[model samples]
Target: MIQLYDSFHQASKDLYYSLTQAGFQGPVVVINDDGFLPEGVTSAYSYYCQMETGQGRSLYFNQLQVPPFWEITGTNGDGEVWDYSQRKAKIFYAEPKHLRRIKNVDWFGPNEKVRFTDHYNRFGWLFARTYFNAEQKVTSRIYFNQAKQEVLVENFMTGDIQLNWQGKVYFFDNRVELFRHYFAEMGWELSEIWYNSLSTPFFLSYNSPEAGQDILFWQEGIQEDIPGNMKVMLNSSHVRTQRVLVQQRQVYQKMMDILPEEQKAKIAYLGYIYPSLRENAGRKEILILTNSDQIEKLEELTQALPDFHFHIGALTEMSQRLMAFEAKSNITLYPNISQKQLQRLFQECDIYLDINHSGEVMDAVRKAFEQNMVILAFEQTIHNRDLIPAAHRFDASQPTDMVMALAGFAASYPQMVALQREETSNESVTGYQQLLGKEER
Candidate 1:
């Protein structure tokens, strides 16, 4: 009896049917965070990776629980090799405190609670390894086939699934799809997947009807415009396209308030002037603090902006570790910082550089503007208008071009900084209203 654990609804259903059809005489358990356990199952567990069991590993009403599980035998979504030993350690140490464990095997009960992570990666391999390491027992590997547009079918315990491309297999995490696509391009068949919260409906909030409808629009839009039969397994709950624009305005305005009375009244260029003074030519090291998702793209820009120093910051400890591994010699890489420290940094920078964005970028801009910093941005970028004030705009395509432009505004840096503060503090709710209008209409 092979135990196949999965979480996605439609894909899980497909795997269950496929496994049963393959003549596996065991139960397929579908565990989820919403306290959802399939009916007629023996018991529920928190996660598949932890070694908690029925007796000691109890949740609400005596349910058994396990730690989080992830598949680690293949390349990861970020196009990097996964550290399996570290991943196994993460599996063991990261488990919830309530569950107990012996050597392996986790257990839960009828009324016990379950746990789930926001993302699932490497779950298939993790479970397979867990069962294999424990009692030499194994189940199967199920996944999607990109080229054929089908799922790969195979049983891992007997190594039956090895290299044999059968029918289509479900991919629980789209990141896994990314991993598979990247590795498959290199002629490697990466097995295993971690299914996340796609089996059931998941949105940012239950109350926003407009947000829900807008997501539907992006989903359909992606399907129609984007080629290929690739399925969109998940999407953000709300449309965050204009948030950066609003923040840029707020930050620029706030900067003006913090300026000296005379500095505030300086009669200089009002909108998007390039720096000219030797002292104000962004000579000070400028850091663009940002999250993990933007790091890859930002790294490319840094290569072009050789005159400007660059730094990277990610929101998570995991990302920090990854950044440490990827950090360059001259570039500073810091772990996540508090909002207070971030605002202080903004004040210290001569030039506040921000990526044109839809969501969190606005928050960063608003913080910078409140500290009275001069901002630089691309003129024609899509979200540039929403995230960056027109007064600070610059040509973003080439860094050499921007440096030449900045040399002109160096002498007028004070004026630009003051303008930023004034723009950020203006209380007109026009931008917010515009954002609301999009979702509302």
Candidate 2:
């Protein structure tokens, strides 16, 4: 019998389907944390990277398909082998005819119930295996995704790796071309490069020196203009590391004014992303930076302002209900737009309505301000409120009030231009580079 343990769904499901379609027969054990997976899925997705060759003939691997680590030849009569077997990801044979049922057991041994708590962080799995030149056991920091019955296993751990690759010019280039260039320089044939949005990690392969670098992902405070994918960095097998970077920045100077002892290091005078501003080519465009959470607010605002062109830059997929608003000619909703496309929108729009969800100092709002677009925020934090002008700020708790204020502002076009003047500009994030490069005189 053959079995596969898949820890993630995105690309893995496609892999499974392709395998089954290709006539490969095997029982698959997958992460069932959600408890909603169809029959045939078992929750124990940990990589028992080692095999007990004395008792069993087959060696097992967890999620993503990998190059094999070990092999065995037919045992001799004297408990010795005359031949060697090739190691591979496929589990050619196994001890069990049927998929093993997980019985409320911990990886160490069996129990009456599942040992892992719902909120358990994954690095706690010491039983999980990491393979180096010789099999070396290392702990991983992976998140348990309950809904999809998924976790990233093996080389798919996502984290950020910053290699000073001949300075930062390579950072601005395309992924495929840059990788091709790297391989060309190294004189290696590039067989495959795989990365997906979900739990499956990315792999950059060549030889020992290029393989095990860590990839960093900024989780919490990301004040940069970047693509939807670049926001996260995951751990990969060829790549190394287990933690995600949660970068936080204090945007308002008033925070220091309130603090008796100002932590200069704590706050960012200018946030990430060098601003590229444009003079108001003002198209009477009103932009709203939003995500899935604020559907109702977005709908109401769009319906209320039928006369105005409302451009909703959806950072992520919102409900179909809000998506339905595109039926109205006045509302334009953009889902998962590219960084360049978003920048063009910023340059063209006249007013930026940042009725964003709570706990966000949205980089979009800042980017719009750098372009001298009128900034309006609702239910923003004190830190964000201080950054936005009083004339433009409104209480999101009262959606009607927010709409009315916007309506009033729209009626008074001259007032909008005056508010832009009242708001002061500081040295952009580009200038911060000089400050960072400066030496104490």
Candidate 3:
């Protein structure tokens, strides 16, 4: 059995976790090698060259090797490299410094355009470099080995891949062919395949050796009609797909509404088994994680609901504007919050206020939802609308309504938690066992 995916993103991670929790023991293969995949996840690029598994080392800004006399400037989320009395040389983007591991570094040329980007593996090694043209378009990417030697080159201009494995040189017309070559080289039997994408993964499965039952775990949103590839998997006699598991309930409902009765049997709604970390003891505490001070109507909300204690935290130090909120009797500020403190805040706080204007800090909204916190957000400041329900969202001018709703939720905390649990729709192990046709041991 194998799990094939285009990338090891958050959705892919969730799906992989779900499958593993459901007693799946298979080699997970990712097509796109970002070089920063978490432990146990293998990429095609890494497998072809037989690269060593990542060591899970922490990549810090100071540890990065730079040119002589280059200066390193550290910020809240990322670091910058500047040439001696010259323009910006490179930008290092990564997690918070405390949990820092370099994801990638963008190199700038003399012309100030990004010439290439060095993608670093979590094992503290440079695994790939992506080159960009003058217009900032991707031209080619070169994958490297632990010896820093080029092992594979992918040309975006012509959609060709060149692999120099062992002593042989091979060329593929497209990524699918390259992936097929990889599967052949690995010599793994295509017994049972689980895929989470409809694009490349679908094609690879459809064109596979046809001995295995393909299960499509649909994780993407349905913007319009059912995807063409999914339709093929559901209706095509040539395809080996036996079932289509929709991860989102709304998307599953949409598929049910569109497909006929016969096709509906092949589809089912499945959700990840999210961890229960919520301890809503009716404390009436609200948590807000932000990197910036542009929290909309924060003062109004704090002033309106004096009974509800607001705990605002940032990974970095708060500015004077944000610090002014400390004067409020109901507000508590946490600057430079550690991982332990953050987890405690998530567990203690019953509500998460997504009214901060900025990029989300460390996927806080999702974490809040997983922690089973009641999420309330204003339309203008909401970062992720998918997790927060429609009834909980309010306009910027409707702070009074939001305050009232918070009060109502606080008054009926147990009922609010029940609703949240129902809305989560996390599937149990039995549902997954039934889907995979496995009997409980």
Q: Which candidate tops TM-score?
A: 3
Order of models, best TM-score first: 3, 2, 1
After superposing candidate 3 on the true structure, give the runs of residues whose Cα lies further than 4 Å from its correct spot. 49-51, 54-56, 84-88, 96-100, 260-262
**Cα lDDT of model 1 by residue, 1-441, tens digit:** 222233434334433433333333343333332222333332122222221221222122111133444232211112111233333222221122112111122221222211111112222111221222233344443332222222333344443332222343333233223223323443422121212122211221122133222111111111122212112222222331111111223333553454344333321111111222223334445656544444323555555555555544434343543465345644665565544655545545666566533234324554445454566665543232433556666655655555654555557777776565454323223332333232321
lDDT of 2 at 130: 29
Tens-digit lDDT string for candidate 3 (1-441): 889988888788888887788888878899887766666888678876455454547467667888788888777567778787666645565554446567688888877889999898767788889999989999999988877788899999999999988888999998989988877777877867789888888888888766778888888888768888877777876678878988888888988998888889999988887666656777789999888898999988998899999999998889999999899889999999888999888888888999989888878888887877888899998887767777778999979989898878757777766666566557777888886768422
Question: Which of candidates 1 and 2 is the stronger one according to TM-score?
Answer: 2
What's the CA error at residue 289 for candidate 3, in Å? 1.4
Q: Estimated TM-score per prediction?
A: 0.30, 0.36, 0.91
The lDDT, on a scale of 0 to 1, for candidate 2 is 0.41
TM-score of model 2 vs. true structure: 0.36
For candidate 3, give the lDDT: 0.81
Candidate 2 per-residue lDDT, tens place, 1-441, comes to 122222434234433443343343444444323222334433332221111111211122222222354332221110111113422222211111112111111121122222221221122122222222212222222232323222333232223211223233222132223333444554532332222222322323222144333322221223333223332232122333332222223424443444234222322333233233565554668877664445336677777877779888754565787688789899888876556767777777888777656433245655676676777766542234434667676666777876776676646655665565445322333343353323211
Per-candidate alpha-carbon RMSD to the true structure: 20.7, 20.7, 2.5
Candidate 2 vs 3: which has more TM-score: 3
